[model samples]
Target: MKPVDDDVLLTEVQFKELFRDQSAIERYMSGPHPLVLGHRVIRDNRFLVKISPDNLTAFKKEYPHDPIVDLLTTPYWFRVHVYYDIVTSEDFVVLTHGKPGISDLPVVRIHSESLFNRFPLRTVGNRTSSRSR
Candidate 1:
């Protein structure tokens, strides 16, 4: 999702030991941008590290064909689905699509995910559904 953080790197053991919810921790670890570095133990999980504008050579070399700078700079967006979390009985996000939307203000669709077995809470509005997913 973003550039990896070099500072505050943690090992698998340290990560497992540090987090209480093993399942949630596992998701974080296995996700595309796992916070752990050496097997992904970085502290900053969300925001991407700023890529050096001048020295993109090495960065490009490290990830040939995968243009990090372009991907980061280009207009990229994701289509998110707003659904209710069955376990929590509250709203949750499920990423349905990725890439910029055709319309600037795309209409939000409220649908009950098949996995949720008939959950409620559906609404449609111009509001950004809290930018779900």
Candidate 2:
């Protein structure tokens, strides 16, 4: 493998074409946003969304939390899922609030994506997952 010295840059048009998704790009380009944890959303928006079966399996593998406890305690009504993206290292959750249209046209909360801030130096107990950062 050769170590290249020059920076590999792409034009705006090239960048946009390569990455088809625009919402994420627009979200960051638009403005600042808040950072919320999956546990907090589950705790706060308990009635809003329910854990999808597929997500439950994945979540159980990643995080050390009992969703059943949250359900038993708070009691969610609708079916939704908390998704974790390993590539971006972000949690993409949908809180429908038991509404019909929300699941289809979700209200997205956007935030600045920062790898440095995402993986902070903290105790293992406080960390979200055992996966390498």
Candidate 3:
């Protein structure tokens, strides 16, 4: 597997601090929107989901009897990470709610970190951080 980026990792303290903002909490509570990430499936075996009209049409053509297609096309809530460069007070207010009609893509916030990005520390223990892990 490819190495995780250090900048993407967040310390436990930083994670807690970020989550403490009321707006951030509100945003998380409001979300779970259907957004796609690069992660593997943990539950359902369904690998790909057809969302757009073209993809949906093709999916139906391939599997006419599959019921999952209907579910995929419908809106659903999905939780996603929202990365930020500098953790500011305003971020809490901006990211607080789910935008209607917005595509359910989860947001992964890539922030600055030393261990992940610094080339000198290449070992997994030295470089791996929790947020990206």
Candidate that would win on TM-score:
1
- Please write out the lDDT profile of model 2 over residues 9-44, one tens digit for every residue: 222333345334656334323323211112112222
* Candidate 1 local lDDT, residue 132: 45
Off by over 4 Å in 3: 1-39, 42-55, 58-65, 78-88, 93-133
Q: What's the lDDT for all of these models?
A: 0.41, 0.37, 0.37
Cα lDDT of candidate 2 equals 0.37
- Model 1, runs deviating above 4 Å: 1-69, 97-133
Per-candidate TM equals: 0.24, 0.23, 0.21
Ranking by lDDT: 1, 2, 3
Worst 10 residues of 2 by lDDT: 34-43
Model 3 lDDT per residue over 1-107, tens place: 11132112222333345345556435423434312112222122212221234444665777676543343433434344444446441222123213423433433
Candidate 3 positional error at 69, Å: 1.2
In candidate 1, where is summed lDDT lowest over 10 consecutive residues?
41-50
Query: Please, what are the lDDT tens digits per residue for candidate 1 over residues 8-86?
Result: 3232343444454557445434544443322332333312223334444545566566433253344424566676755
Model 3, residue 25: what's the lDDT?
Answer: 34
Candidate 2 — which pairs collide? none
**Candidate 2 runs further than 4 Å off:** 1-80, 99-133
